[model samples]
Each structure stands twice: as C-alpha cells, then as structure tokens.
Target: MEENIDIEQLRIPEALTGPEAADFLRVVEISRLVRMHTWGNDELAYTAGELLAQCHDPYEWNVMLIARVNGVIEGCAGIAMPLDDNTELAHVTLDVLPQAEGRGMGRKLLEAAEQFVRGENRKSVLVETNHAASALAAAANEAEQIHPTSGTGYLPLSSREARFAFSAGYELERVERFSSCAIPLDEALIAQNMEATHAPHRSKYRVHQWLDACPDRWAGDIARLEQCLDRGQSPGHGDWDIAKLREAEEFSALTGRRTIVTAAECVADDALIGFTSISILNHRQDVAFQDETFVELEHKGKGVGLRIKEANMTKVMREFPEVRTIYTWNAPGNSQLLEVNAQLGFISAGITAQWRKDFNAY
Candidate 1:
C-alpha cells in the first residue's frame, strides 16, 4: 500500500522434489532468517533443506511472498493451508528486518499475506508476534502490558508488530511467555535436581529416552496425553477444532527435525505417564527447542514432569555439548509447568502473543 514498496509472490518449486529444489530452498532459507531476526535470537536459524521440506510439505501446502522496496528483499510472508482438519482456517505470518520496521512494511506484508489467504476461501486466519517482555515492559506501556486484552495487553502497543496487528483489527487471543536457560552442561546440578525429583517418584516410575521417533510402546499413551494439551486453556482462541491434534504422521513429515524425547514410565505397568521432547535441526545444533512436556492428569503432582525434563536436558548436556541454551514457551496460566521451568533455571526471555482475525465475522 506504500509507495516504493512492492510485495510479490515468490513461487517455490511446483514439484518440490529433486535437485531443482536446491535453488528454491536457498530463497526460503533467506526468508526464514528474516523472520527469525525479529526473535532477537541469532542462534535460531533453519537449514535450507529443512525449510524446503516445510515449503513442500504434504500435510499442508505453504505459500511464500517477498516484499521489496527498491529491489531489496527486506521482508517475507508465509501462508499455510491444512489438508487434514480446519480447512476453513488459514495461518499467515509476516517477517521483516528489524531495521526495516516502522516504514509500514510489516502492515504491507501482512496485507499481502491476507490477500493470498483470502484467495483460498479461508474463513479465519491466525498469526503470532513475539516481543521481548522485559525490554518493552520497561520502556513504556507497563500498565497496558499488565492487562490481558488488546487495548491494554501483554504485547506493547509501542511495538511495530503490535501496532500493525491491533490497527488491522486483529484480536489478541492468547499470550504465551518464552523462557530460556543457559546450559553449562553442569552434571552435578542436573544430577542433584534429578535425584530430588526421583526421591518421591522413584518407586513408581522410571525415566527413559529415545533419539527421534516416539517408541511404539509409548506412542498410544502419548497420543492420549497430547490430546489434552490445550484442554482447559484460557479463552482468547477462536473457533476450536480437532486440527490442533498432533498425529504420528505429522512427526514423520518433519524429517529434517531431530526429536529428543524423554519419558517416565510406570515401573509396574510400563505405561508412559510423563514425557518431554527437545527437537532441533542437525545443521544448527547450537540451539534446541522444547517441543512438548506433559504429565497425565492423575499423575501430575508426582514429579513426573520434573524428572522427564531433567533427564532430557541432561541428555542434551551429554550428547549435544555445543548447545548453549534451550528455549521453551508456556502460558501465564500454566503455573505448574512454569514453576518447573523456573526451577530448571529458565528465565523469562520473551513473550509471543497469538492473535486471530476473522474474515467471516466482519
């Protein structure tokens, strides 16, 4: 919408197979980095081939766009349409160089992404924005940041991304806090925590871990656990659907991701009760992510979550020695897991707010 700014659709390989995908992947990698920069974490990056697999993934078809002003790719956008469930919903994301902020570039890129999503007959679209809470909360909007809704919410209106989303009539649906811990691979500290965690639950459960795929023994029970991930979540989300459920097939589609899953099994029954996973790409091993860490409802207070996380983080310490820090997200309402993360030395790093805009409502 702004002069000198041009948003053009960038076509990834129509048939994203074979050597020709290499050229397409290079562009994708560049675009993904532009988005990652807004996270303010340099160690966060995606490999060209990994992102290539994502672009042409079978579970969902993703659309990419590049925004330029004077012929420089300063921003990019991605639109995804799911094939399994929630077909009426589209997910869109716009990323711009930090230096390129405040020039109406993000709003322009978002508009371009929305136009593409609308073309697919989507009824609703979801987007997420991340801002450093401490940084912004301290700057100004402290009171507004303390509030939960858009007019005054966790996301600072002073932020460029927040301004664009709120001005565009996007509703703040959910606010999630991002936390991180610097891992020195301190064996004694980890051992102490694991010992204390095992003190109460040792007689009932034992810890086990796997490299990538979820083991056959744990798959079914884990599926049951995953189903309740957002069961009693806070209300800011739009029309709920079964689409958020993670299935085994989805894991297979993430061929480029390496998942380190740690679980606690009942010693007597061999049922998987608690589990945590840290997934990362092999090419970018300096950083890893906390995928999912859940303990079954009945077994929650028995320290299962703590032991599993400790075991998995300890595994990262032993195996991936180069990894400096691990990042994880939790809702402000999730006091249980938040306490676990705090005990694990994960301080608040940033907050990512999920916002939704309904095309049909308006």
Candidate 2:
C-alpha cells in the first residue's frame, strides 16, 4: 500500500508549550535522529529551546514544513531567510526518518519549501551536505568527483545528498573542512601556543575578553569587524551595524546559549584589530562551536589570529570546563587559519559541501 503523506507549514508559537508544541518538538527530535544517522552522532542537533529561539529571532525569518504519515510525524524541511542581510538567499535543510526513505516524503517537503521561497521572491537557495572524513578517500578512485565553483575542494559524486542537490539544479559553491578538538586542553599546550605565537610587535596589541554582551565602548569597532567577516562571505552586501550586533547577541541569549569572545586591540589608537568567539549551549556543554575569527587586512600576518584564538581557548577552559570538544568549519583554501587550528589540536573530522541554486540562472 502507498502511504498517505500530508505536509503543512508549522506555526511557531510564542511559548513552547501549546497546541503546536508537539509537532515542533517532533521536528527537533527528527533533526537529532537525522544527524545521528548521518554523522554517527547528534552533536550538531539543536534542542527544542534553541529551535524556538531561532524561530522567534527578529533578524532572521525561519519556517518549518512537516510531513506526517497517517497522523505521525516522519520528516521536516526548514527554510531560513535572513532579514538583516542576505535577504535574497534562503537556506534549506531537509531531513526524513531512516524508514521513510524512497516514499517521496523528502521530495514533497522539499517541493513545498521551494514553493514557499519562490513565493517570497528569493534569488537563490543554499543547501549543505556533510560527509565523514574516514570514508571520503575510500571511494575517491571509484566514484565520480564534484568540485565546487571555487575549484579548491571536492566531494564524492556518489554521496546521496550531493546527487539529490545536483538533480534539483543546485551547483556546488564551496567545500569546508569540519574539524574538532578535545578540550579542557592541557594547560601546558595552551601556554606553549600562546608563547610560540607571541611577538614583540604584538606588544602593541592587547587582548580583551567578554561574555554575551559587548561593552558599549567597543561596540562600533566590533560591528566593523563583523561587517568585515560578512563582506568576506558575501561581497557587495551591506548593513552590518551595532543594531544588528545587538539583535544577534539577544537572539543568542534567548536560545539558551552563551558566547565567549576574545578581541585584539591596538594600543596606539584603541582600535580593535581582530576578534574570535565560541558559543556553547548552556544545557549541553560537552560540545561547542568556534564561531568567527577575523583580523583586519593590514594586521593579518602579525599573529593576531593565533593570539585571539589561543586566548579564547584558554577562556573556554576557565569558563566552561565541561566543554569536552570544540568544533569549527574552515574553507579548504584557508591554509593559514587551518594551520592555526592544527596547532591548537584540531583535527579533520569531516567535510561539508555548500550548494546553491540561483533561481534566475536555473
């Protein structure tokens, strides 16, 4: 018998506990299951609380479409569009239960999401696939390879997600190395890294550390650094300012997460030269994500990146001792940052390929 699958857009309630909470929670559970099945672990799964915050976040618009088989939830697709910037791009994530494959549930949800984004007049859709590092080389010789437009990295064409995106008219955009480092790192290792990267010229710069909220004095400079990072990701995009920074920090706190930030400042003029940050789930401290590390172009080769990253790691140990692992993503072409991460004990765990479908081109 062909199963009957019904898809509907989920209404995110103001409070988590309501008539709609059950479906929302099921979607969160499905996300956990999908990550576990895909990566052999659920480290990247978001908690229900976190999902609620994301839905309520003011700077971004998010919607979830759920697929139910005979009144039971089985799959979901999420579309996230940035209201602050990248307004023309929608990020889509689709997940279906292991037993529900090949029954058209994923396809239905994806189609629905595509229709919704198109209705909103989005210019492009972005999707990502994660592959285990150990298995990549095994099929490198046997399977076809797909390289991103950057031409710097490749993913096996045999991967299911890659094939799905390719068939759907998406093009490979970039490949990023996913890495993790065991934390509560040896104090000696941290000390050694700090000393090795230290320079006399570095004495002109001082490191500052803070929690979730930015100090009013450095707000403007921090916004500038954030804009720098944003421009690096998407050129010709604008509107990253102090207001957006506050909105982001407020959303992070509302998501039951805490952020630890380390920033470098020039002593001569008191300008921020660079900054780095790590975000941890307050309820689940075993793992965290290394958010952003950016340094001004003029200060790139002065060991600013390493100094901020190392100082941030030391703070992570002092503040969140339960953080056993810290994970980060880097472009394959960014050898300098990768080398800094390597020195900090990070190792490649997997690779994630970013795909994009430009509606006008397609």
State which candidate has the highest lDDT.
2
Candidate 1 residue-wise lDDT, 141-193, digit = tens: 34444345532236666676677778887888777888888886466767767
Model 2 stretches astray by more than 4 angstroms: 234-237
In terms of TM-score, how similar is model 1 to the real structure? 0.84
- Candidate 2 has an lDDT of 0.86
Clashing pairs in 1: none
RMSD vs true structure, all candidates: 4.3, 2.2
Residue 157 of model 1 has an lDDT of 66
lDDT of 2 at 27: 92
Candidate 2 lDDT tens digits, 125-148: 888777888778677785588889
Q: What is the lDDT of residue 235 in candidate 1?
A: 28
Clash counts per candidate, in order, are 0, 0
